[model samples]
Target: MEVDHLFEIGDKIVYPMHGAGVIKAIEEKEIQGKTQQYFIMVFPVRKLQLMLPIAKMDDSGMRLVLNMTAIEKVMDMFRQGEIDRSLTYKQRYKINTDKMKTGKTQDGAEVIRDLMLVKKEKALNSNEKMMLREAMQFLISELELSNSMTEMQAADLLNDRLNVEKDAG
Candidate 1:
């Protein structure tokens, strides 16, 4: 039987709060007496795999990895995105967490930009530090597939851009 698939094998898609992965297979699985088509994907950088029911792809918040032009635009936004220093810790954390849920590369970049700027002023609390790490990983995962960058290359490029403000300061 032909399967109606939102993403086929070899497609790069990002799952919100989970990072990005490449679709590796489509298989039919029986669970709780329900047989359904699922897409299997491997997340290379994070060294993980995921299987999602094809019917629930939209609910899962999966989207195609940013294309070349879009990725470039995101990079520019990352560099230009401003940090609001007046927000209380509670407010900032809430905003950042909401961004992560959006699963947009741009939102992830904004989280990095805001927290990194905060770090430059004062050490991040444990929660902020963890958020920064996860944001960086998520951003890197997308860059790897969307921009054809190695992990090191993506990390270096982000670090380099993050340092632009430091040089000017």
Candidate 2:
């Protein structure tokens, strides 16, 4: 149960199933008679605050946003357009969900690319649509932070790079 202490206040981090957010504070709270450190994170997009136990940082899939060089690589992933659309929707959903849970920039891009391909051929069900939105948001938020781009700029950049629809709503 070793937690990697890599984050500090003001550091931008990404949480799996969540999005990019800033660490607002660090505090210790006693729970069940044991005191532990936590990172207080504020997600502006979601308008949510989270107190993540420091001891569970790695286990929780929290990670620093990619650096600029890494982000460049992620952008390249979008250009390849190598989506595997052969799987059934259920199978694709499961695979995409697993990728999203990894909270990696490239994985998120892959999900967006795959789903956008699916959407172009046919409309997605509500669940798939939601998943596409979330994954795109996750990717965009990280790009915004890591690249110091505005949200609109990031969205436009991604749209141009991936050649996908703009309806990430």
Candidate 3:
């Protein structure tokens, strides 16, 4: 398997389990007398730091942000709003968690889709609601940064595609 250099120092990247983080530094260090390179990433929101070995980057499933075309596809799915809502919460949660673990941008988008479907059905539990908010925030921030749009504008675009009227009484 080829390992693509998907991140650079000072760049922001998203960890599937950790959400978004900035690459604080890249360093060569000796581990057990062997030289290894690592990307030091810090998650400001979680106050967490991760030292990811470069050799394991692909195994770790790290990836660059989705391109504009991919984002448009995800938005189309959101607009379609055709996800099955009959699945039990546990089943839905497992599916979303698996998607997150895959660390693919499309999987992340699927998480957003599932959460939005849950919300629209008024089927989200408290924990699920919190997870949904985090997932949406993470996805929106990356999309906004990648596409050079404001966070609010990005969110509004998604809402509009989903035909969700904000502040509708």
Stretches of model 2 off by over 4 angstroms after superposition:
1-4, 82-85, 164-169
Judge candidate 2 against the unseen true structure and give its global Cα lDDT, from 0 to 1: 0.83
Instruction: Estimate, for each residue in 7-45, the C-alpha lDDT of model 3 and write its tens digit.
Output: 888886777777666789988888889888899988665
**54, model 2: CA deviation in Å?**
0.6
TM-score of 3: 0.74
Per-candidate TM-scores read: 0.91, 0.86, 0.74
What TM-score does model 1 achieve against the real structure?
A: 0.91
**Which of candidates 1 and 3 reaches a greater TM-score?**
1
Instruction: Please provide, for model 2 over 63-98, each residue's C-alpha lDDT reduced to its tens digit, 9 standing for 90 to 100.
Output: 888887887777666545655656888999999999
Which RMSD values do the candidates have, in order?
Answer: 1.7, 3.8, 4.2
Cα lDDT of all candidates, in order? Answer: 0.86, 0.83, 0.72
Once model 1 is optimally superposed onto the true structure by TM-score, how far is the C-alpha of residue 4 displaced, in angstroms? Answer: 2.7
Q: Answer with 2 or 3, whichever has the higher lDDT.
A: 2
lDDT of 3: 0.72
- Enumerate clash totals for all models, in the order shown: 0, 0, 0
Native-structure RMSD, model 2: 3.8
Q: Which stretches of candidate 3 lie over 4 Å from their true place?
A: 1-7, 10-12, 20-22, 30-35, 42-49, 81-86, 150-153, 164-169
Better of 1 and 2 by TM-score: 1
Q: Model 1, stretches more than 4 Å misplaced?
A: none
